[model samples]
Target: MSNYCIDIFEFGRHKTQEVTIGDVKMGASNPIVVQSMTTTNTNETEETVAQIKTIIDAGGQMVRMTTQGQREAKNLEHIKAQLVKEGYNQPLVADIHYNPNAANIAALHIEKVRINPGNFVDGAKKFENIDYTNESYLEELEQVKKKLIPLLNICKQNKTAIRIGTNHGSLSDRIMSRYGDTPQGMVEACMEFLRICKDEKFFNIVLSIKASNARIMVHTVRLLVQKMNEEDMYFPLHLGVTEAGEGEDGRIRSAVGIGTLLMDGIGDTIRVSLTENPEKEIPVANQIIDYINTKEGHDAIKKVDTDNYSPFKYTRHQTNAVKNIGGNNVPVVIGNNHFTKDSDYSYIADSSVIVSADKKEYPVVKYSNSNEFDFNNHELCFVKIAYSDMDDSAIQFFKQQNNVVILLTSNNSNSTIEQRAAFLHLRNHHVTTPVVIHKLYDSVFDANTQIQASCDIGPLFIDGFGDGIFIENNTENQSLVINTMFAVLQASRVRFSRPDYISCPGCGRTLFGLQDTTVLVKEKTAHLKGLKIAVMGCIVNGPGEMADADYGYVGSGPGKVTLYHQREVVKKNINQEDAIGELVALIKENGDWVEPS
Candidate 1:
């Protein structure tokens, strides 16, 4: 669109030809795009090609494979050749860093090259980690630019679409030396790179400013978009929360971070970074797109609506409903999932109140750590809970809460034993509390039996639960449950346990005792509530992951360590002999650590 973003985000105003990669296109005028990064090693051509085919078969239109070195780059042509031979004509992107030559090479076969300027530029030599208040800072800045111009040109001439990616790692040492590794510093550095690309006549570009911090990630995107808008610019923004772990938390955090931005209409493309297989990312990424553009009669978004009902739009109205539900003291079980105490549950606790129940009157209870159900002093206390669709009492309980609860139950509620058991749970629970019974696509025969026996007679329910309140009823697609739950939790006043761990998957290169350090750190800090700490391996992704954490310890060499707090390096070159004690002491100094036992 605007000239301000002409180079960094060219919308092709004159032509607006859909920018297709393989078959996926993401542009101002193009339809919503879904993409994923290959988890296969670039050097493994057979495995990589196999994975790419699987991705395409699974509905991925655009894919990215890493090209970390010349070997991988050399192998990339074969990888492309193989894909072409196999008739796998999807758009592929080469994720290359540091080596500009690699970028030039990758551009030969891949549809795009994702360049991290922070890593590509040579750090100013004269400006070594010293305070700029000293001298030589301005001179160093001039020298840094002198070095980066050539690489920028090489990319421009290749007709490559540069993904201006800014990460905590590979930060231009000059920026780190001046601003430290903070979100603002990262965003500013990325913008500067975009400015450079524009100056060098590189107009085909996509932009991403990523961080591991869920909060920071969301905020940075918001700020970047705001800044771009102020300057009257529009570019396709890639969304991701890096180092966002595997399994439950990773998915939840990515959904929260990416979902928050998409809701604000800030993201154009997205990648769900996980430590697991890249194929898993495709389904999650697609669901996010579907969730955002949910509307009646929208087929593409609706296809993933496994529940047969139109996808639910997360709007201000649902938020208002949560607010309305929070004003009650009735324990609300929103779904059939087990309620685990001390896990900071989002679905099954009354979060409206913060104080102890002993001090309050009837219907008052201690709020779950999640704080998802904040209530007024006089409002009815309702603790919302959820379970699988096969739990009948859980499903029945849905009706009592005005069907506000999420019901994940079997589609056949009365055909068999499992279905009947589920029906009983929903039927019984619906008599008193708010419950919404979501039907499962699978056979509920066995599942219903399990739920009936488990919940109906358990000590927690032996005394029998009571019907409490009823709110509203709507069946949600299971594919979007995780995203919807997170969306709902965010709308509520949910709380999360802080000072989490970010450990690496040990590889051959892993050294400096990552396993012991991680275990020791977690054991030492176990009781330290609300303090985020990371024990990471070599400086590669460690610093970035640690930036998202409150504090971190990273290995540089045998018996050498670097400590970071609040994303800024506080200590360097500490001997391994004193590393543990020193790190613990530093953490204690910040008063974020639980007293060491």
Candidate 2:
């Protein structure tokens, strides 16, 4: 509950009531499930079934499809029939928005229904800030309860599990009026609906609170778990970074958010929402879960007081400035012999290292706990310590140092747990010496390794632990290691070296080709760093979902696009062919455009 997992310093899954969804049962100590969703139209049985097959074949444990209307909801029956005929028994979840009837119909046909509480009973968000006193608010809650009771009744009758998903950017006006569009609002939105389900004795429920910002997503999920536990309600959580985009950006972002929670033992299932083939997402999901599961029976780590930490928001571990490496400085990336080779992770370190080290500007020196520590005078003193060495005595010594930069590392099988425990110990003792997280990966170079590296260190940074990161990967591709370091930093909200795209994986409601449009948007906007851009498939959740993005490109119709500067609509209904150009023009008009070198 305090920037932690079930066991904090060790490993254990969070406990929750079991829920049945057709062939798939989730929560409690059940295996962390991997899931994917189709991009095909719901009514297209052949294609939808085809994608679901691909997803399942790729180790997807469950599949979800968009059901926007009654027609599509009815079509699910046919899709389920086709899958059954073909001997596919995996549960099919229907993603419903603003459609209780669709939820009712899909409940009759599918195994689960995912409804966004923001839109379900509140209807489409008018973006209004409604004035409500206690009486009015209570009246609104009664109306919402009445509206949702019927859906819960149907789901209970059909044995269809319901996921009351709350997206941060898309909170209902009623909730926003009171909670002000924050994580609390997202939780309240879902809790309001969940109370209805509980009152109706419908316990077949899972919950998801998501955000495009990895930090917000992790924070909200952690807060949600605490809130539910306070009420003695333990609903299973479905983990995802909603609208996480394609390729490396998407992978890093998803790993940062989803992997952090999985490490905390909070999620029951996950979907790496990438704007690619549904099958392609399954491997990423599998890789993330695999890396996290490796720490399940890990070696014990020494526990420390966590009253200094909060999982819901980030406040960098307090430290005094040591030149450019700590205390208000952006996280620094240190070079190692392996990753800093022909093309090192440093600032051209081969030549730069000699000059910088010779000048005594700042230097990295490995410290041994067995020997009495030596503090020599230099412009800045950088000392490294293994996690095992950061005991009470070492922390007391480092606490008084104004020029110490601690390099923290771990060799345990459960590297993150050990390192996290060490950080907590240091924080509890009020040791503010800047800490740079260091991890060595001797594993093969693959998606699993790439994702594992991020997951191992990501949670520390997200929990506001480290000041810098030092990485070493035993891969011939040094650039891959370099990219991962920056990716972890960016994904942790510690730094940004590339523009972030809050692009959603297109659903059946998507109007045009989503993948290609995302590529085009990235191609034109790659040079525009420090900007958050979203390429959403439709207006349904586009504008609201990418709420933090500096610019948004949302699909308004078939081959038509809408552009936004922040949340304000700058232009609408531009042809898809010219949408990219218009977006650049819009960026230039707003002074965010920059030419690629």
Candidate 3:
């Protein structure tokens, strides 16, 4: 049994207790739920209801709205009445933070209430470290539980399911003091409340552990399940990458985080958190669901021999250096046709390599379970082996071979996991051959292709499996194949050919034009390669939300913005029109700014 997955080799959904929210049921073999949160103000009943309809039409199985205080909490009654009046009976969930009374009011009026474990009775995040003795920590946990039990009781009485969501950026000062914003800290922050729920006999619970970084989001969710297993907790997971910005970047980021877990049979519900309209997020979530559904009944993957792998740690499997392809090199992206350095070129067989075969310039050997290669003569060679055809003999053939790189391909419906298992086998056998992940998509390069490639190849890079990627897709031009590969590599955090952006999907609390502002920030900063910039809707989770970003643009109020250099506030409450220039000035002052090429 794997800590991250129910069974690392077996392809199936992670079994969890069913949580009923009004008419919708989630987890435990239920259709993986698709969900989105509204950006419309909750008090505007008409607008909220209309947006809910649009979200449902766009395939949102459940809709969530922000309820910050008594005003928004009470307004839900009118919203619910309006939705029911229009013959729309979809379940409604209230997103609660920093208010227990709002959660109690929401529990009585809505189908579900989500409480941030970081805020519910926990000390506010001052980002200060408090060295807590064991006695002090336990006492604080007890006090927090005593305060939360009342909300759990209200939820139980109302038959309302509760989701304890742990956002990476919003971890409280107490939790962060000891665990320091890590995967273990995220799990424990959620678990303290879950333990209270258990003690109070409140069983209807769903859980979420999210981050802006796609790789961290995946790692924490995997670790959450592992920790839950140890504690006998099987709460359903709500998978998402918080603040995943709009357009293809948002889609690719969501896929890399959510798709990686879904491949391992984790996640009960998913939301593609985009900075655009909430309704636009549903179709992207649907695409990820449809793509992952294709992995269910594939040919079984062979069980790995010895798993010396750590789910919490990211250590690229060791391999011999093959030029710029592997061994501490950033993972390369390869196109089917000849391309530049980052976009490397590859040959499928000897027929195409015939011209270069004599010179052994870039020759490849197709393994038919035998090796007749002139290793002594060639300085370097790429050995291709069907991942499905690999066994002890194949591993033994390449175990001690020098000047060799492995090209892995698979036809199994198991998708990425099949290739993953092959990587494990090589690692177990002490093979240091650099590996390149290869996939052939029969369809043209489109939205599906972008999502599918990020899902398949991105995870390998996130988990440190493949040394390079070679993608073959039916497209009219080479740009489709080459462009998509670089995007996947960038999303995977294995390489960066563009500026990385993190922007939150705005909620009712957001008081500015988040979508347009995010676009503006991206347009201005897109040329800063390797720089991470965050465009957040509001300060509630903004300053903390950017994670490792070098700069942040946070909406502090209507027509106002705040600029941050990492976590320190550089400028507070500047006019929206002046924010971009001030941000650029801050970047330049910090020695991070470079002129656009």
TM for every model, in the order presented, reads 0.59, 0.95, 0.96
**Candidate lDDT (C-alpha), each:** 0.52, 0.83, 0.84
Better of 1 and 3 by TM-score: 3
How do the residues 138-208 of candidate 2 rate in per-residue lDDT, one tens digit apiece?
Answer: 99888888778888888877888898989886788889889987888888888888888878888999999
Task: Report the lDDT of model 2 for residue 207.
Answer: 94
For residues 257-333, what per-residue lDDT tens digits would candidate 1 score against the true structure? 66555544556778877655567777777766665443212211101111211111211111113322322322232
Which pairs clash in model 3? none
CA RMSD (A), model 2:
2.6
- Summing lDDT over every window of 10 consecutive residues in candidate 1, give the lowest-scoring window: 310-319
Winner of 2 and 3 under lDDT:
3
Pick by lDDT: which candidate is best? Answer: 3
Which is the better candidate, 1 or 3, if ranked by lDDT?
Answer: 3
Q: Compare the candidates by TM-score and give the number of the best one.
A: 3
Point out where model 3 deviates above 4 Å. 338-342, 346-351, 354-361, 369-373
lDDT of 3 by residue, 1-597 (tens): 456676777778889999899999998989999999999999999999999999998878899999989899999999999899888898999998888888889888989999998877763567889999999999989888877888888877889899999999889888998899788899999998888888888989999998998888888888889888989989899999999889988889889889998987999999999999899998889889899899888887778764577667687889888776688987766666444444556443325341121223566677873366676776667777877778778887787677777888888776688888888888888888899898888877788888988888788888889888888764667676777788788787888899999899999989888898888888888889999999888766787777698899988888999898898888999999999989989989999888987
The true-versus-predicted C-alpha distance at residue 512 of model 3, in Å, is 1.3
Error of 1 at 488 (Å): 8.0
